[model samples]
Target: MGLDWAYFRRPYEELHDRHDAAERQEYLVGRQPTAAAHLAELAPLRKREPIPASGYTGDDERLWQIMKLYALSRVSDYLIELFCPAGDPPPGFGVTGGRAVMEGSTTHRLELGGWQINATPGWIGSRRLELDELAAYTGFFTDIGLTPFEHAETFSPFHHEIFAVMQDPSATRVILEEVLWPGFWFGDLLFSRAGVRVRAPRHLIDAAVATTSTLYFTFSREPRPTSDLSHNWGSNSQWRTSFHRFYSDEDGLHLNWDGQVDIGEDPPQQPADQSDDPNPLDQRRELLLHRCFVRSALPRDEDDRFPYDDRLSLTTAEWPLRPESIVRVPWTR
Candidate 1:
């Protein structure tokens, strides 16, 4: 008995009140014409000025703008696998049996298990608004100078990306609150991360999870069944690969920078047969499975998966914690 259908069909970069980011960048070049012809060879470096405002005269032109943001991050990874298609969706996409709670204000809309989860990106209306108008038609990366960020105070899985947690257990720490999307770097190379919403601290979470109303990396507020592998590449070598960064610093949290995920400075414990962990799945159960917002078991690597998966699972598990009532879990360790 849940049928609003997020208003039939919305995201073509929004209309009604007018927002068209060039029709979501021409609907990603009419849906991936070889990553939209190498994202049209960066259209004259997105009309120049990513950094040359009298800067970077040498060092090979700042290593040629980090190799043109690693070839425009392979058209932002084939435009988020042609619009967020990784895993878990369709067992009732946004089935609103209600109950998952929290409606407005914090803007999370969030809910899980009872299944209503979302972290904004098109909110089930326009396929995650094509990664928020393809990150504002790729300007967020600052046209290539790189820096585009978005913070939420604290909850570092090496630059957020949790999506929702909300379980107080007295809330001693791990309280970010919100930040739907925005991550960029290219220098330290953490190309993407920001997508938060947390509260956490219930003997280390497994009860309050969030997200998966069709979300994985980015895009999918509607238009479910997504897929990647650059749809099998070779169509111009999938626009030129390399650009799934998640690195961090001060010495840790490199979620996957081609060393193939799991670098860590924390988050690497829980293994009571969470499928006997294997094949490089650490960083503390992948930051306690994104601090328990389960879309579980991923690190099997299609980029990353298999740290554990049952689509979702975690709870109480033989409880025996209370580190001075956790004022910290800075992503475990």
Candidate 2:
């Protein structure tokens, strides 16, 4: 049987709605800062106009807008970290550096590293330089503001939770239509990594099932997992990445799965008496999802840079809620 979209759509939609209401309530009550004000303040720094979308052409304008909005949101987060007093650390995360201080009665300034610098100095001075540096590498600076520790424990997982929900179909639509698209369309432009969106909840489920099926079919051959030949066949980490391509037609979504099955070096010959012993160098398969999504169907020269070959492909027959079919194509040399 193929992928079942109906089975997962309901739960995903409910979770998405709950998330949206929670976010709205958070913003309304002043628990979360408004995105509009932040974007307006940083408007002058944007470098590009919004990429317009004519037909689908596999280039989704909304997806690009989502990326831009996400970037802006990160910048806003960094600014909060820079100027506001540090709040209580999230669970498993700790803060080391002292909280940021605001100075100057008439012209407020940001004080970090125990020294104060003019916050709104002219476009070409030290203040601009600081802002530029923060904008260019928002993630790095945000990490610095959070803690001096090198471990992942220093950062909060709140954004990740939101992202996980965003991948769901109901959540994806809500976010694309309500939250992200609005921010992208009406808000000031900013920098973004790419114009693609991946990990839509349904797409993710498809990728996982396809990957598992591939592994199962591959293992069920002459060299079965329970067979002695399986002993000689060592497995290495599996790299799995997914991306989405949009279409104007009925099949509006294409979820692509690229996976690499690493075949490790031959294991050392075991003593015939100890054949049942486990190989110390036995490798485990690890899956890595490359989160990047492209902006258009136009051929990119960098596509050749992908380390894995196209192993599995799946696409929906209808937009939004239909089940997806696994596309089978003949292998090429």
Candidate 3:
């Protein structure tokens, strides 16, 4: 939700604010995205998709690259539509800015065309100044059978994206600190992990490290080169991709959307679907969870591995994680 859904810096008036409108009515009034042209553009993306087959492997990095590419393109659509019409974000474009809670406001730092534009704009009386109105435009997702999920009672790396964290030295486990932004679900497929602030032990989740702003949804939460989808496909099809639906309960982790793809058993460190490559899963689904949502909630090699330490190894049952792939834990659902 952080970088993937970057702040729409303009005033709320710039967005036809739909908070007061009904969900159905909002869809009726929002941008009428053309599907024929957009789908044609996204059809080629599947040729590079590596999920279910590369769920917990090295190729997962390539998957993250694709996800960031999708997010950047979507966020760029809002930026170009609202701010700089003449602007075109290059291939390596990334943003750095978020809520300044101390000031009770939000700001953005956009580097483009050899200049840095730091914008601290007013939210036009909206409660969430950081969120662009487009974040709420879920018509494409819902209309196609995908569900948008945001609220969670507890904290789980699988269900919530680590936007911000609190260090409690005496804390035994993660506590639900705050909800930053909503995530999405497609029946059992986790489209996007909900953005939330989590309270955890400093030993398990470092405060300074986790709070340090970079790009939250980018490849492995670190800098990496990715493509822009808007330059090719419209925003419509990118909203429909694929993700592994994993669920957590009092028992433990349940991979593949409570057994959607059925990776034989749980703890998908190795893919169990011995089916065909490229699809093994999506071919059997009615809706495709956007690859952007596949940003991977687990910790990966040299990527956000600091939040997890030997303490986590001792408590693997607490949160089944790997950092860059898809999975669930026994906490937030």
Which candidate gets the maximum lDDT versus the true structure? Answer: 1
Model 1, runs deviating above 4 Å: 1-22, 34-62, 70-156, 159-169, 172-189, 201-333
lDDT of 1 by residue, 105-218 (tens): 544654332345445322332222236555554552454355678765665655655544556668666666767567666455556666555665654443222342222333
Candidate 3: misplaced stretches above 4 Å?
Answer: 1-129, 132-144, 212-317, 320-333
Instruction: Compute each candidate's TM-score over C-alphas.
Output: 0.25, 0.19, 0.39
What is the C-alpha lDDT profile of model 2 across 158-180, one tens digit per residue?
01111111235543321221111
**Candidates 1 and 3: which is better by lDDT?**
1
lDDT of 3 by residue, 1-333 (tens): 112221212222233453433442454335334222232233323221223522334344434433433442343334222321122223322111132112233467633223544554321111112233334434444443345776676665556655445566788876777765566553333445665666667556554334332222232322221222222444444432222234333333343331223322232222244432232222111012211211112122222211100011111223323333333232212
Off by over 4 Å in 2: 1-310, 316-323
- Candidates, ranked, lDDT: 1, 3, 2
Highest TM-score scorer: 3
lDDT of 3: 0.35
User: How large an RMSD does model 2 have?
Assistant: 24.3
